[model samples]
Target: MRPFPLLLVLLASASLSAADVTPPKGETPPPATDLLGNPTDVPTVSKEEAAVLVVQGKEAMIESNDNPRRSVDAAVAFSKALKYYETTGDTDTICDLEANIFWCKKRMNLDDVKSFVAQKSGDKTVVAALAKVDKVANKEVTADKADEYFSRAEKFASKNPENFEQISVRYFEVAERFVGTEVGIKAQKLSLVAQQNQMKAIKEAQDAQRETLFSKPTKLNGKIQQTAVPSTDTQKSSASSIRTLYKSDFAKRKPNQKQNLLNKLMDQARTTKDDPVMLHALLTAATDLAMECQDFYAVISASDLMAMNFSGVDATAQKKTAFGKSKNPTVLAIIKLLDNPEDGDANTIVGKYFCYEAQKWDLGIPLLMHGTDADMKSLGDMEQLKPDGVAQQIELGDKWYDIGKKGRKGQPTLEGPMGRALYWYQLAEPKITGISKDRIAKRMDEIDSLLPMTNLNYESLTAKQWDRLKGGMAVISAAKDRNDIGLRLTAGKKYRIVPHPTDTWQPTTYYSSGNSRSVNWKGESLTNTPNTRQFIYFTGGDFKEGAMVMQIENGKWMKPGLVEGDGRLWLGPFSDYAWGAGGKGEIRIKILPADDE
Candidate 1:
């Protein structure tokens, strides 16, 4: 279980204990100043003598530095001196002695210092000082635990290098368990490196095994001989037989062995001339193996190959069976690799899945929408390539919109259903025409209306506020080049400005999503050339350098744009404060809100 609240624990630990005293047992004695009007047990020591005791205790404490045994002696001296000071009624000296004793206990066992101080006094100043000590002690414990976990993870990896999954999981656990510590951060980075190396080793070992199997001398007619020339027919025959290649022993093999067999099949496919069925099968198996291997780059290559070929081939009965066995692996592998790639045409495979599989719209729509003009031309007629892609979007939108209406009655979770419905509807708008377009637009607007409103007039917004406006809107001033016009945001919000109608944003096309039209400082539409918004639209400052927008806060500047969302470049949460920046443009900020939002 998590630890108790810090403040509560400290407060409880700092409470003072009861005073120590002894009562007479077996006899009752009563006297008023011993019948002589004098207080019993009053100290007769002079003020000078008490002062000397305090000086001696101070000397002892100063000498105890870095000497824990000596610290105990100092505590003893302070305890003895405390009585003298108490008799003299020098409260400051008494308090000083109590604090010295606490320090002595800390030097012996820092963890016990809190309890020791609490037993002595309930002085807030003493408790406050002890709290700082407690923090350092707690930090020390955390650091030790983090280091121990890190060491264990390292030793486990070293002792069991073959257990990549287990080792990586353990390392990641250390990273997460001690999240903010130096050891945890190092463990996190080391875990990533370990994963990368494991993947590389797997790839290298596979290559070596392939060389051993395929590079050997061929045995022909009982005579072993190396062939200098490659056989084209042999390659073709290998491609034709891939379906039956591993069928005999396939079910008996382990995952890694299965991976090796699939690798051989892929190798055969690579060497053979174009055979659509074999290519599709190989692509399917490659994707499955890549997923299992957690080889992200391989998934990207496989997805690219499938997208460029799968649509052109008619599936054979065997191919259909293989595809069925693959369980639509391309969709999953593509989703994993989508954000990692900088350039690729994933439209064909993504569109096919979007059409037939009826999954992956969260991933597929962005790939299609962000396609360059070349990508669009590559599709010929989008309808011919996949009719159901558009239909699926509409179907999903309707389904989710119904869920929005029915699920949770009224709650934030409504966004899950309605936002998804709007997402599909909006994605389909640009691809379809006429009533279809109008229908999508209408549904999107209706969903948007029901969604929550974000008040952006504030200089900065929190992550929750940012999430509320995702696939929604912000009410703010019109586009202008002034600090007052910009939003103060952090990396977590990661908002980027774009032109409202542009379908995307760039540093060269920065503007507010809140108000599209150029307006005066009050945000009222300004009198200017009708298309003046486009000319005055803010473009090219820091965003062109990379960030989509620059923030200016209190005469300081910061930039946001660390990660990509759907098609938009969004910034991550800031590590430090980001000041707002001012720019004028007709462009507006648009974010491809995360699905979980």
Candidate 2:
């Protein structure tokens, strides 16, 4: 007879809150927005005015250092100060402002600070800020009653080793309370050991009881005869085999070990007449191994088994009970096990399979993005996809779009989570090539059209409103025809203009003083001539190329009527290509976000 009915126990006890790993929450930061939560636009300021704003912003930042609650106000002040100082390229001042902003954002528990720093890549100021936050995050926190907890655990394990349930709970408490620390990690391992030992003891006891009952002989008919009893040795073996499969170290094993083990599991499950206990265990073990190994084929094979045996979650009490008797009684146990903390690669494996093969977008996004970001940073290059980074990004982008589309269909809210799709697409665009590049580019435009853009009162705005418009805001010309109206400002400020991709250009052909017939300025010295009217020109580089519209900023001048009189200029900071003509209706401009490139 099998030694005893094997009791396989899978324990998941340690968990960390999302907040633990997030940005700082220093003291108490100021509010994210004004009391009404509405942002005001920042208007163009003179050099003197800009200086005054910077000084005032610095004062607020100084005050914020002592009172964390003032961080929000400091952030706001620094942001506005940046809007002015950026025009002058004040490197020192800009660094100070960015640092303050990062600190405040961290203290507020905002994640965007990291994203902002990530965009800058090599900027020393933002990089230092990021380092500071990381240092704080890694700093040790004093655990309350850590020794007491450990003592209690020792006492419990020694006194009630047979009480597996209570023992597991105590160990789990210790593990959870001290996660990320040396003591906590050790406790977690010990908890697993305790659970396994207790389970083995129970199985042995049951086996002994069965043997005693079976060993008793019964007399039959005239002659005394021994009883022939059926054996459950096969069932016991199946359970034991599954446990061994889960615990085996894949790294030291032969390449064929996976296939061999899978075949063995299948044979055992089949020989047992597809018993739920054996089959479920087979599925769970395969999944855990597949994730641990980061083996694509194994993952696929395991997925097939999961579908064939478990199928999906049970909805009824009766069905739930039936599944509970199986090796992985609950679906959660299988998933939770696959998400092992020790295996850094498992998440990507799990995420990729879920998104691409299983079509589980909800579970795939967070893991996939996290893995992709980690890989990108570790690899140290924007275009580098040393492994599967690019592929994952592409797939993640597709899933995000699909999810966003679903959200839009379900509600009328502007925050349909659709923007995430575009965000991922943009991230993947620079890393991919060929057909994928074309596909992503086309999809980006299509999605942009679908998204709503906020049209600011560009004629007059506060620094707050301008900052808000930096990433996704736009402006439309109210006039039926193009007009010479645009942002008016003092000279010396530099601005990068970006015409809308689909905007209408007055002339279909490229223009120069030698070939300006379209604008009726042919034969005039428009190119490199002092007498010719100054103009804004656009051509070449990635993204749409054309002199679509003329914009006025910081006193710069453009040729008379190049656009169809739209009365507003659509522009972006850090555009790849564009040149502004100096003097005569000149407009000064500043690129906000300081041109990530």
Candidate 3:
């Protein structure tokens, strides 16, 4: 999940009154215009009329949640109130009213009352809309043509087997042009294979050069010398020798002997250079001995040194090479932790190694929180000074949630700070009741939404297609030429829609307040409610208000999903309230045919 900007949230929820629209005493207001300073023919109203309209809009908006039909009334009232503010040249109130009008229209389709009714009674319009989209999305590609295209690429690859770079590019082009077809999928896979082969060839060439250089005889100090390159066997032998020099059975050794050995390992680490395997062995021994002796600082020192020396090195391969096939519990746990930090048992063991054995509270807490062991959990609870009362527990949960929301410092852990917050919330869940329970549950839901989803994969594409997906096509404003993608979508086809990371725009310049306060493709919600629901009453009812909305050949607006029917594609920010006017910036979107279709 992406971070929500606090300033946008504040702006969305803020309210304005008639007083905000009134000019200061003895000050002349500017001429009527929109928030962007464009000239407008806003008819003036009496102060009494403006105040009454504001009150009516507020009342209607408040009642609309319970009776969604009242949203139309609320929208009308806010629109009139906005005109009055516009006449007074009050930019702040005009901006507030514009946003309120947007919320009113949004609620007309998304309020719980209306949504429940639609669900129970079946909305014909929704069914029709979906059917229309599906009709276009399900359109089949010309299989024979796609096959012919793919065959040519395959023949090219067969002819130029050693030209992996050219072969990959050919396959990638076929994959991109005929995406969503079986031949396209095959082409994409082959493209990946060709790229991999190319990389392997490059690596092999580099390795051969290194071998020739190392084995070559060179003159040094008036004498010819042959340099021996380190091999797998040589590295293993060096590591073994270093271990033998430092290793001692902790159970058989006295405290002074263990300390002496630890000191010797540290001294070796300080002097060690030009030999990574020896350094790894020395640090690994020091870490294990430090844990055995319950020395927090020493364990941290060893771990830190190991990480510094092995930056960018494949950690799993390095550990496996250093401690090959070791069955020692500590060694196994370290390997498992490195391979999969989220493994509960591995986390528990490592947690104990840090919290109990080494007494490094900061490093151990996150692991213990993620671990399944009851004793370790209790230890973690004690480390945090867990309170007994339900109220206190909720407070603690909130505290952690806030910390996680703000994010953590230093190297990121697997469970993450949000996971830690979730740990506390889960603990408080069963203990609370009524509104408190509901609040906790809501918070937990938010955290769940915010937490990263594992194993989520998108449709496979070639490197060129992947680049296009990430690069995105820009949709600037609501103009036909700017928003249209020129490609027609079929009814039965599924497409993945992703907002470009850097593409942001304000639906109205009023929200900018003379700064670059633009929002992402996912627009800000002006209400307390989650801005994730579709506004089915509008053209883009398939997407939430403020999100990037699309239309099929100027038909009903929809978001990323299976095409309902065939039509030309058009994309833009959701700006129905402004009637697709007065917005700054552009929205870039990536459209790809989903493999599931």
Candidate 4:
């Protein structure tokens, strides 16, 4: 049961009472006739009977109290009374009865009252109205009719300037209905104008009301008094205000001003130990501003202080993990650079650590350029001076690979060294040719084989591989393969995909689905199943289910297909609906850039 507003009930009652006017006492009632005043076979009721039925319908409606099931009963009674009034040509009573029936049906959630009445009375007017409604509901905008539709909407908008809401909706509808058409493009622009106008009108009204409210004086104890307004300057010394200034104003200041600000902020942080909010804010401002200013010494100092004193539950832990504590020579050298940014020996050690160990080229290359290591510094200088020189890039890659191989000792491949080598090689891959390309490919394969195959680890890996060069192998875990891989595919760029020999997975112990590139389900090919659309291609026949599938950004899933449109790549087992749920084992895939067509 849905309760209606009291106003609706009163209106319904008023209509009922006005239409239920009793015939003058002892006056003879007019003979029954059809709407056209012609003889008809339609059933008619006496005036007394009609009156009784109306009373009964009203009673039923009152008792219904907006309950859906009870309202149906009221609708039936009103419908019968409506028929009698229709046959007797009592237009006023007929209209009232129809309204009551409509209301009852409306309460029961039956909104197609026009069709219901049209069918019941066979009224041409009601039928015409229903047909018009159906036409609008089923309207389709095509190139032929797009202009006409746009013109009509424009005309309506011109006629009703104040009704911007409806005008906006109408224009937007035209835009959506005929997308890609000229009218649609025009409509979209007009729709934005109408929406802006609507917002402007609403804002103007609100501003006027606000001004009136604040401008008017209030009476207190028969005396007019002014309202007190809060001052913005009161919050100037707040921690949030400090943070806001750091973000919005810090960068615009001169270098010496920046230094002064950083010193003042650090002093405040050191002194305001009791106020954790202010302390954290001041330290954060100093640290971030120093980082932006490339004052590594200040950054290290402020960060260490914050780490020691921050009271946040996870702050210390997070800082410790990010700025790891170690006695390693490389770490100590990096620490030395904090005291003197120009220390060549320390920079050399720190640069190799970032390049060969951390595999963060963005952080490592600049340091390498400043370091004393002749070969590493030369490569870094070449990268900065001639970034697109393929031969130099390849030579640099060879240096890294050779050094990584030598550094391995008796252990497995050094991930950082090998990753750095791979990064340089990949940068040179698209341009190198013949034996050089084959050599690089072989080296990459060897590196890929030596690297451990494991699920994508967010803690140690990045979401996209366009920057970092960890390895060639991308591990697709059966448990969580829906995640996007680091590989980004450009539109129409060909890529060579090679599955690792160990690329095999099973949906369950009972179902061993060979390799991820090809899989079988019982005797029937799961690829033939219509449910395959849910996994990959909307048209499913191209690729097998349970095979490796790729999605382009948030677009449709499909086979890797080598040459894909521009988007990030994702690899996963193709399973319909279940989507590799409860699957075991992992898929290792190697994606390489192919020569451009």
Worst 10 residues of 4 by lDDT: 530-539
**Candidate 3 lDDT tens digits, 1-597:** 111111101123233322232234675342344553322323334554565556655555544444455554555445545555666788546644554554443344323333433552543322222222222223344666787657766776788898665566566656655777788898878878887787787667644332211122322222212223345686678767866654543334766467667777888886776777777678777866765664534654565566556544433354455545556575576667666767788777766555433435466766776689775565455545434345556666675566556543321332254455565655555456678778887777676665543212222211222344432454556332227666676766656665554445656412211123455555532221111111111223444334566677767766543354687777776654533555666665566555332
The total number of steric clashes, by the backbone 3 Å criterion, in model 4 comes to: 1
Per-candidate TM-scores read 0.22, 0.19, 0.26, 0.29
TM-score of the candidate numbered 3? 0.26
**Backbone atom clashes (below 3 Å) for every candidate:** 29, 29, 25, 1
- The lDDT-based order of candidates, best leading, equals 4, 3, 1, 2
lDDT of 2 by residue, 1-597 (tens): 112111222224222222333335663222232322212232334554455445544444334433343444445445555555666777655544554444444444333344443454533433332333333223344697666666777676788777554455466556655777776787777777766776687667644332211122322223222122213675467656667665653333654465456555555544443256566566556545544444433444444434444434221332223233334222333243233422334444544444444334444444444353464223222212212245666665675566566544323222233444555654455457668879887777666666544322232222233343453333422222233334433443333432222222223223331222222111111222211122223323422222223444322334222222223443321112343121121122223321111
Q: What is the Cα-based lDDT of residue 472 in candidate 2?
A: 30
Q: What C-alpha lDDT does candidate 1 achieve relative to the native structure? A: 0.42
Residue-by-residue lDDT tens digits, candidate 1, 443-543:
77677666655312112322233444444343221222222332444444434332233222122222232223333221222232111111123323332
Report the poorest 10 consecutive residues by lDDT, candidate 3. Answer: 1-10
Better of 2 and 4 by TM-score: 4
User: Best candidate, TM-score-wise?
Assistant: 4
Candidate No. with top lDDT: 4
Q: Rank the candidates by TM-score, best first.
A: 4, 3, 1, 2
